[model samples]
Target: MSIEKHDASVPHTGVGSDLAEEPIGNPGLPAHTWRPTDVDDGAAKRAERQVAAMFVGAMVCSVLFVVVYFTAEIGDNQDVFLGLGASNLGLGLTLGGALLLIGVGVIQWARKLMADHELVEMRHPAKSSEEDVATTVAALSAGAEESGIGRRPLIRNTMIGALGMLGLPAVVALRDLGPTPGDALYSTIWSEGMRVARDVLGTPIKVSDMEIGDLINGQPMAIFEVDEEGEPLVEGVELYVAKSKASVVLVRMEPDEITPGEGRENWSVDGILCYSKICTHVGCPISLYEQQTHHLLCPCHQSTFDLADSARVVFGPAARALPQLPLAVDDEGYLIAQSDFTEPVGPSFWERG
Candidate 1:
């Protein structure tokens, strides 16, 4: 499309010239260009087949996504491709190709097959009258008819099949939500005699290692334990899952400053106390400590718990106190857990009675 230029030297002497002078002549709509598919029946048929082929390709990709999701190994036994996991690479390419093909096919259908008439919509008030609403409905019906969806069985059927195939991936993904958590959320790797070790380095912590107002991010020693072969007892995804649930924060304060809850008189050793690092509100690791107040703040939601008072929720959105792990001195003077947490850790769930 090209715009026609107007000469400013010419004086406006037309019917509306007395009211206002025209700075530039209004350029009307350009001549409509006809596509080969619009004029030739053979070209239109070929375009229809090309669109159907794309929809078929989309269906194939969607099917491949489901196949890769089930057959591809994940976690420790995962296969590698170009320095990335094969499962991830395959799933991404297949799903992405499926979406891309569908989008391209829709664009091609509109450009080559749909009604090519150039229309100009006049500006109107925001409010639509009843007659305008009826016209809009009629226009939509006309558009559907012009698109030839009812006449093109191949394109319509293949497109529907491609869209239906997309749902298979979603259905397959639902499996990840389960093997139902069962009693897993109610307990963690923590058990009798599991020593409290510092995070990352995993070195066991002794009472002497902590000072007044000191806070240590710790985890269960089992994560660091090695087998007779010198390999980690827990590795890969298993290690991650264990660490997330069994993580703890050790805090030390004045012995008199501590207020033990009912049945938790012996839960702490000396002035040192241990609580689940996971926030009670959402499960974000809570390590932001205010030593003077003995409060543990969750950075994610600002849920604060008073470590000096049975890890009680003193402020913010936490609905319950942080779960305390019963502490005991091992034969080697390292801090050890007396048992698993008396209650479930992390955010409360529906079945948590």
Candidate 2:
């Protein structure tokens, strides 16, 4: 068949006609500019030094943390800071600076030294041809080569070693968590004649000092008193541990309101009685009280105990009653421990024997 020509005045809608009308050709890519660190030897060297300095700072901070842990006394009035303990301040600052330095170092290395390139990839259908898969694998291998991870054995090994060493501090610190409590929870420093004192402040309590319906959180006088030499009485980790376990609540009820437990007839002096402040439910300190009902409540888990009935668990999830510390009056009329608690304090644990 012979082809017929269209009129010149007509608009064209043919395939070759569309190609001719389309945007002329590919615009092609913009020129690439290399970073100073990539082109200049001096800039690369400077960036490398800056990154090394940050890592060195991190190492120094880590060392300082270990030093502070040993040198700083944990709870001496001597180590007081701006109302915070100096020991805590030093530990927090050193450890935090170490982590911050590592983070900053990584950011600087990436920004000032590492390669920077912008890429444009064409979107395609989800399925790929076998050739595309091969190309992808080759690209990944090329990227690894460009990253220099295999070539730079020193940096690779150093990074691995540093990260591995970080685990050592954690393991070493676990030593502080335990040799286990042993029978410490079952007993305290509250021996016979040891005066009951305010927790932390350590002021001795007299029967006359407390008013009826009053509850004062207290600890043993041993925490504060010095030996004959005038040296610190309780000077180490043992002191803090003792103070924590020996905490008590001294409550004064009317003589008529007191009903002592069996074998606890003389535990109170003129209706002022003492009980272990540590809750039996989960070991939270208990002090919330209903003076009228003589009921003591643990704030955690709402474990209620009847203080009048020997601190029996009257309600809530408490598995056992609060432990009562037997009390007596010393020669000076200060409230004293008749003995250490007859039962374990705080949450029940195995080996409390």
Per-residue lDDT of model 1, residues 242-272, tens digit only = 9999999999999999999999899999999
Write candidate 2's Cα lDDT for 74-183 as tens digits. Answer: 74444867878887898789888877877886677667655555432334458988977997898678667755557545444544544554554566568688796666
Location of the lowest summed lDDT over 10 successive residues in candidate 1: 10-19
Compute each candidate's TM-score over C-alphas: 0.67, 0.51
Summed over model 1, clashes come to 0
Best by TM-score: 1
Please count the clashing residue pairs in each candidate, in the order shown: 0, 0
* Superposition error at 58 for model 1 (Å): 2.8
